[model samples]
Target: MRILIVHNLLWAHYKASVFQALQHLVDQQPDLSIRVLQIARNERSRASLETATDADTPTYTYQYELLFDRFLEDISLTERAQALLRHARAYKPDVINLTGYYDPAQLLLLAWAKLNGIRVVMQNESTAADHQRSGWKELFKRSVFRACDGFFCFGSQSADYLIQLGVPPAKILLRKNAVDNEALRAVYEQTLPNRTRLQQSLHLQTNNFVFVGRLIEVKNLPMLLNAFAEALKRSVNALNWGLILLGDGDQWAELSQQIGSLKLTDRVTLLPGRPWFRVPEVLALSNVLVLPSRSEPWGLVVNEAMVCGLPVIVSERCGCVQDLVHPDETGFVFDPEEPDKLTQLMVKFMDDLVDTQRMAYYAQQYIAPYAPDVVAQEMLDGFREITN
Candidate 1:
């Protein structure tokens, strides 16, 4: 069997880990082969998010191809479609797994696959809660979904959305997303000894609620600051607790101004986004991980934090919340729109009302099943089921 996966970025280390694991599985099967065609290096807006400074090459042990050395969005739609089609025709895969349905260039390849009787698998991270449903877009997506042989979703939320669109539940191959937990945990453990020195050098408090991601509007940075301020006002341990904002975006100046206006400059620190591997270094010095995105499909940061044994405070709207976060167990989930609710959860952490160590243990255990190897095996099994 020949399987070809169409992915967007070569610098997505998390995806690379899964691809590596999948390749390892395929190698064990003498009759199977898998290759990934990375569309671009990274998106323009997300250039800062990448740790690699070069043309975004794969560092893992896998058979893959880089179609372009630049961002795909910079390429013309016609050029992209032509390149994708050329690669698909040359490979003549028994099955083609699309990254998502958002890209029309990939959709053209999907259409061609259907006409040629090649099995198609669609991987979706978008949930109904991520955006407002459009009747026309729904109609178009239903047509697209109809051509696919199987589905791989981010979580239950995403899988349920496909079911609502009339897809049979049996067709949903995988409903969970994962990161390289063992790799991330190893990095975190290596950085553990230097946690004290790192925190002291940065002048960060020993116990802090850290938010790591793009400092954009959708991340709800303003609300995070406001909620942290409110929690400070209500906590006796306010002096010992702090907020760490990690990542760079266009909203830096505005977020800085808001921090000043809220009189939180001394308590809040904004750091530039670093590579995925270095995230464990940041998580080492922090006590809790917080993601307050107003609209997040699946917050993978939560998985990274959990792997490092740090409890998370994620938004209820995030797709990972239902599958990974257990309310008051692994961590707490608050409504992003409700500042007061977020403030209360923050206070619980600050006041030591929640058992951080206990919750952290639960977090690590809950995240074990969502490892890259598990997800890769599921993908392989799904391919076999469809092809046979």
Candidate 2:
């Protein structure tokens, strides 16, 4: 059995870890072969997330091919489609796993695979709450979902969306998203000793609620800032806590202005987005992770935070909230629209209402099941079930 997996970006370390494990599993099967076709090295919006990985040029050792040695946006749709079709025809795969429905090229490949009687597994991350669902897009996605033989999703929320879009529950192969937990844990543990010094050097408070991602409007940064300010006002241990925004985006100027107006300029610090590997360094100095996005698909940063032994305060809208967060046990989930709810949750941490150390332990324990090895095993099983 020859399997071709089409992916959009090559710089995703989490996906790379899963693929590496999948490749290892496939290697044990003498008659099975799996290869990935990465459309581009990285997306433009996520260029800052790229880090200086180890000796491996691709960051992970996996059997894969790169369609273009550039970002997908730089290439035209025609170019992408032609290259994908050319590669698909050459590989002549019996089964194909498509990245998602957004990419026209991959959708075209899905169509071709169906016409050629090839099995197709669709991977999706979008949730019903992530954005305003369009009737036309839903109609198109329903058609695509109906045509695919199996589905892999980010989490329960994504799987639920697929089911709502007309996919059968049995066909929902996997509903897990993960990071390279071991790698992240190692990096965080190694940097643990320097965390205090690093925080001092950066003038960060003893306890910080860190938000790491682009400063895009969809991230709901303004609301996060407002909630953090309120939390600080309500904080009894005022000297130790602060908010750290570890990303740069188009909203920098606006966010800066809001920080000043809220009188949180001293309490809030804005840092540029760093590479993926170096994230552990930031995570080491932080007490908690906060993702207050109005629209988040899966929020992989939550996984990263949990792997680093930090409890997360995630928005209810994030796809991972249901699967990863345990409502004040692992961490708290708040409605993004209710800034006051976020404020109260943050206050729980600041006022010593919740045991941070215990919650961190719980987070690590809860996240164990979402490891790449586990997800890869599910993927392998899904492939076997569909092909059989």
Candidate 3:
């Protein structure tokens, strides 16, 4: 059976890792063959995250075709659609996995596949809580969803959203997502010995809570800063802890102003974005990873943090909270709207009220099942189940 998977970005190291593993698995299974069509080289917003990955050193290697070797936004809808259709028609896949319903180009491909009697799978990541859903948009999504034969969701939250839209539970083929856990952990382990020196050289505190990603408004950085300031005020051992915002965004000036207003200029440090592979270096300097986004589809950074053996503090609205955070175990989850709730958890970390080491151990254990190779196996199985 031939499977053609349409992915939106070639910049996704994590997704590329999973595809690499899938390549190995498909090689072993003589009955299975697959090709991934990367829609674009990278999205403009994420280009900075891959700056350090040398072109010659392709750690993000997989058997894939690039439909557009440029930013997704720079490619017109007509160009994208024509390229996708041209390649897809030539490949003649028995089954096609679409990126998502939001992309008009992919939606057009879905329509073509339906007309051609090709099996189609919807790969979804959006959760119901990601944003306020309008009725018309939901209705439109339902229409597109009705055309797909199967679904592969990022997690239970995504699967639940599909069910809410009238999809049967049985149609949900795979409900998992993963990152390159082994590679991320390897970098963290290699940087472990110099963590203290690195922190000291950087003038960072002994313990730090890091927020890594774009400084976009949805990340709720102002609220995170407020909560961190409050936590520092309330914790007696606060002097030993600090906060790091390791990303650049449009909100840089605004966040910087807020940091000054909250009198946390010294307690909080703003760092620029780095290549995803180098994220473990920041993880090494941090005691915990904090994702205070008001709405997150699935916080993959939590997976990265857990893989690096650091506990996470995520907002309840994050889809990954349900699967990754285990209150007082792997980490804690709080309502983003409740600044006091977030502050209390931050205090617990600083006051020695939480067992950091134990939580770190459990975090790694909890993420083990979501490793790339494991998820690849599940994806391969899902493809076989659908095609046969």
Candidate 4:
């Protein structure tokens, strides 16, 4: 099979999941030819091309300065459409897979592919309720979807969403985001030594609960901070628990202020974002992983945390909650918007940290089947059936 995947690649960090899935496909089927046309972000203008592996897989990066300009959205769309069309003409892939949210460029590319007798697959993280919010973009998206052979979703909820959007039932494939299990396992095994070193360097306690991801509005950092504060105030042994906030975003200053206002400076610590490779170590060091996202399409980090054997507390709004989290069995699921409920869950986890570790063990066992290779195989099977 010759496949072409279309998606934006900003510094190659964003496409790790896709690369993992495709790499698995290449490894399993050596006859497969895969080409990626990565649309570089503005900051990657002078970025050097780096090969991910020694394999014969060819990745081509195209520089587009105006790909993310808000004022020149139409121009950017046209530019991306032209670039994809040029690549399609040259590569002529057997199947073209489109990932990410609905956009004009994606619609145009799908239309062009359909006109050229190419099989098209659209993969997105949105549910049906979310699709209705797209308004006019939904119409364009539907048009492109109608021309496609199949649709791929991250979970059953998303697959059901596409079905509700009137896509045929057989066309929806539920494939979760792929993770490198071996790499994760290796990281987990090596994390104890690294965690001790990091603890000594940062002077962090061993019982701290960690929250990662961007500190944005949808992430519900304020509610998390409030919840942590409330938990600390109510706990009989406040000194036994600590909080670590990882990653940085637009809400950093406000979140920092909230922590200070709540007098949680001693209990809660804010850490800057680290490289993707170091995330497993961070997860290993923490006693629990909290993802209080208000509206996350799919929380891949939740899977990563669970794979690292950390108990997770994710919001029901998170897509991964449906698949990865099983309240009391694997981890807990709380409402992201309900700070009080989040606080209660946090307090409950802190009170039962040993039980949480047992839950973390179950989480690792439960998520074993959804690893990268398994997901890639499922994807390949779907594509083969769709194209047949």
Candidate 5:
């Protein structure tokens, strides 16, 4: 069986890892083979991440074609649609998997696939609570969902959204979104010995809560700052705990100013964004991972942290919270809207109320099912199920 996947970003290392794993499966299985059509090298905003990671050598192994080899924003919609349709026709896949529900370019390909009797599988990331759902958009999404033969969702939240839209539960294939666990864990373990030197050289505290991603407004950085500040005030071990924001965005200046205004200049560290492959190195410098996004699709950083054996303090709104968080076992979850709730969770770690070592163990064990080889096999099985 030939499976064609249409994905937008070439810079997405997490997706690349899964594709690499799937390709490995194809080599062994022989009957199942796949092709990925990557639309662009990177998004304009994430261009910084494309630089100098082991210089010129790719991090993960995968087979894919770069449709544009440029940033997604630089390509015109007409060009995108034409290129996608052209490739879909040439591949003549038995089944085609779309990256998301939106993108008229891919939507047109979806329509073409259904008309030609090629099975369609949707790869979804959006969840019900992450965005404002207007009636017209939801109606459009329903129409899109109706065309697909199967679904591969990011988590329970995304699969639930499809079920709500009238899709049969049997058609939902997978609920796992993954990163290169082996790679991240390797980096984390290798850097563990040098962690003390790294932290001292960077002037970071002995224990810190690390946030890794773009510093945009939707991430709710200001609220995280306020919550962290409040936690500091309430904890006796405040002097030993700190917060690190590791990414850059429009909110960079605003967040920097807020850090000072909150009198958290000494306790908070704002580092520029690094490549996703290097994230576990930063993970080595910190004690826990925190993602307080007001609206997040799946928050893959939570997976990265778990792979590195760090307990996470994720917001309840993140799609990952449903699968990756287990409140006191794997980690804790709280509402992003309430500063006190986040503050209290932070205090648990600071006051040694939560057993970090035990929770870290649970996090690693809990995330095992989301590993690359395991997730790839599930995806391959879904393809076999739908095409049969």
Candidate 6:
């Protein structure tokens, strides 16, 4: 089978699970010939063109003059339609998989694939209406769904949403996002012995919890910070616990100001975003992982943290919370907006008397089935069904 992957690739940062799954599929199936075509704006042309490919894989890239200053004006329909038509003719792929949010390129590719009798698989972070509010945008997005052969959603909610958008239920595949288990295992094996040393180096006490993701309003960081502060105040051993925040975003200044006003500067540490490769090391050094997002399509990082053998506390709003977390089994789920609820879960998680090693063991066991290889095989099976 010859497959082509069309998606946006910026800064050579393809840490997304979909990309990892595609790469894993290519590596495992000898009979599958895979190629990736990255679409970038004119400004990213130099960097995108200069990217080097691994010698072991068959890959190619194409760049065009699509440019826009803001998110809403990124690409015009005609330009994207033309690009999709050109790339489809040039690559002549048997199966085309498109990943990303709703965009002109995605819609055009789906329509062109339908016209050409090519198998089209559309994978998005989540449902269209869940992310966008405009009526026109929802209508446009529904049209895009009509053109694809199959739809792959990162969670069951997303699949249900697609069905609500008029997509046939049978055409939607519910495949949870996964982790690169091999990379995670390698990093864990190398860093497991240095956990205590790394924690000490960072000045984190044994009870510190870690939060990783862009520090933004949608992530509900302010609520989380408040809940953490409340939890610390309620605990008798408040002096021993702290919170470590990873990643930066537009909400940094506001969050910093709130933390300062609340006198939480000493209890919270803000770390800048690290490369994707170093994330496992960071996860291993932390005692627990917390994701408090107001609305999350699927929290891929939750899966990654669980695979790294770290207990997680995610909000019920996050789609991945249902698939990855089994309340009090592998991790706990709370309402992100409710500080009291989150604080209660945090307090319970911290006070649990069970062996930490056993908790980590359970976390690993729960997440192992969603490894990249297994997810990729499922994706391949979906593609086969679509193509046949």
Candidate number of the best lDDT: 1
CA lDDT of 66 in candidate 1? 89
The pairs that clash in candidate 5 are none
TM-score per prediction, in order, is 0.97, 0.96, 0.97, 0.86, 0.97, 0.84
lDDT per residue for candidate 4 within 137-211, as digits (tens), equals 667556666787877787777777667667888887655765656666676678776776887687777678899
* Candidate 4 TM-score, C-alpha based: 0.86
For 157-260, candidate 3 gives per-residue lDDT tens digits of 99999999999898899878899898788889989899899998888999999999999999999999999998988999989999999998999999999999
Which lDDT tens digits does candidate 5 get at residues 1-388? 9999999998888888889999999988767778999999999888877776666234666678999989999999899999999988888899998988778888989989989999999988988899887788889988889989999999999899889888899999999899888888888898999998999998999999999999998999899999999999999999999999999889999999999999988899999988777888899999989999999999999999999999999888899999999988899888889989989999989999989999989989999999889999999999999999
- The lDDT of model 1 is 0.91
Show how many residue pairs clash in every candidate, following the order shown: 0, 0, 0, 0, 0, 0
- lDDT tens per residue, model 2, 51-151: 67566223667799988998778988998999999999999998899998888888899889999999999999999999899878899889889999999
The residue-by-residue lDDT of candidate 1 on 286-332, one tens digit each, is 99999999899999999999999999999988999889999888998
lDDT of model 4 at residue 38? 60
Model 5 Cα shift for residue 373 (angstroms): 1.0
User: Any residue pairs clashing in model 1, and if so which?
Assistant: none
Q: After aligning candidate 5 to the native by TM-score, how far in Å is the CA of 305 from where it should be?
A: 0.6
Residue 307 in model 6: lDDT: 77
How much lDDT does candidate 2 score? Answer: 0.90
